[model samples]
Target: MRVLGVDPGLTRCGVGVIESGRAREIACLGVGVVRTPSTDELADRLMAVAEGVEGWMDAHRPEVVAVERVFSQQNVRTVMGTAQVSGIVALAAARRDLPVAFHTPSAVKAAISGSGRADKRQVTTMITKILGLESPPKPADAADALALAVCHLWRAPMSDRIAEAEAKAAQLARNHRARLADAARERGSTGGQQR
Candidate 1:
C-alpha cells in the first residue's frame, strides 16, 4: 500500500510517502518538510500549510494518510497549531476519499523502534535501518512523518480485522434486535385481537 505520513506543525509540517511490498518490504518514495512563515497571520499560515500538504498529496497520490495524533503539550499555542495542521491533512485526504489514520507519537515510536519511549535519534536510526537508507532521513519531523506512515502500514492489517469483527458484531446485534421487535409486534397483534 502507498501511504502518506504527516507530522503536523504550523511552521514546519513534515510530509513523507512510502510504499509497502511483500514480506514487509518498505520503500520511501519521498520525504520533506512543508514550511510556513511564522510572521504571517494565522489564517495565511494555515492556507500555506494547506497548500503545501495538498501539493504533497497531489504529487504522491497515496492510498491513505497517516497523521501524528496531537498530544497534550505545555504550550497551548503549539498544540493548537499542530492540531490545525493535522486537521488540514485529514481534510485534504477526505476530499480525495482516502483513509486517514492517526497514531500517537508513542505508538509510532514503539512500532518503529520497539519502544514507546524511544527518542528521536532511536526512531531515526531504526527508520534508516528499516528502509535500508544510507543515512537517516533529515530533520526529526521528516523522520517522524515516515514513522507515522510505517506505523500505519504495520497496523493496517490488524485494524482491518478489528473493523470487520466490529461490523459483524453490529450486524448480529441489529438482526437480534429486529427479531425481538418482530416477536413483540406479533404478540401485540395477537393480544389486541384476543382482547
Candidate 2:
C-alpha cells in the first residue's frame, strides 16, 4: 500500500511517500518540504500550502494520508500555523476520499527510533537505516514526514484489526439487545392475552 505522510508547517510543510510491500518491505517513493514565503499574506500562504499538498496527492495517489497531530506548544503562532496547514492536508485527502490518520509526534518518533523522546537526528538516522538510504533526508521536517509515513505503514495493519474487532463486538451487542427486546415483547403479549 502506498501512504503519504505530511508534516505541516506554514513555512515548510514536509511531504513523504512510501510504499509497503511483502514481508514488511518498505520503499521510499519521495520526500520533500513545501516552502511558503512568510512574508506572503496568510491567505496566499495557505493557498500555496493547499496547492503543494494537492500536487503531492495527485502525483503520489496514496491510499492513505498520515499527518502529524498538532500538539500544544509554547508558541501559539506556531501551533496555529501548523494546525492551518494540517487542515489543508486533511482537506486534500478528503477530496480524494482517502483515509487520513493523525499521529502524535512522539508516536512517530517511537515507531521509527523505538523511543518516544528520540531527537530529530535519531529519528532521521533510523529512517535512513529503515529505507537503506545512503544519506539522511535533508531538514528535520522531511525526515519527520518520512517517519510519519513509516509509522502509519507499520501501525495500519494492527489498527485495521482492532477496528474490525470493535465493529464485530458492536454488532454482537446490537444483536443481543434486539433478541432481548423481542423476548420481552413476546412475554408482554402473552401476558396481555391471558388478561
TM-scores of the models, in the given order?
0.85, 0.87
The true-versus-predicted C-alpha distance at residue 194 of model 2, in Å, is 18
Cα lDDT of candidate 2 equals 0.94
Candidate 1 lDDT over 100-151, as tens digits, reads 9999999999999899999999999998998888888989999999999999
lDDT (CA) for every model shown?
A: 0.94, 0.94
Give candidate 2 misplaced runs (Cα > 4 Å).
Answer: 170-195
**Residue pairs in steric clash, candidate 1?**
none
TM-score of 2: 0.87
lDDT of 1: 0.94
Per-prediction tally of clashes = 0, 0
Instruction: Give me the displacement of residue 119 in model 2, in angstroms.
Output: 0.9
Clashing pairs in 2: none
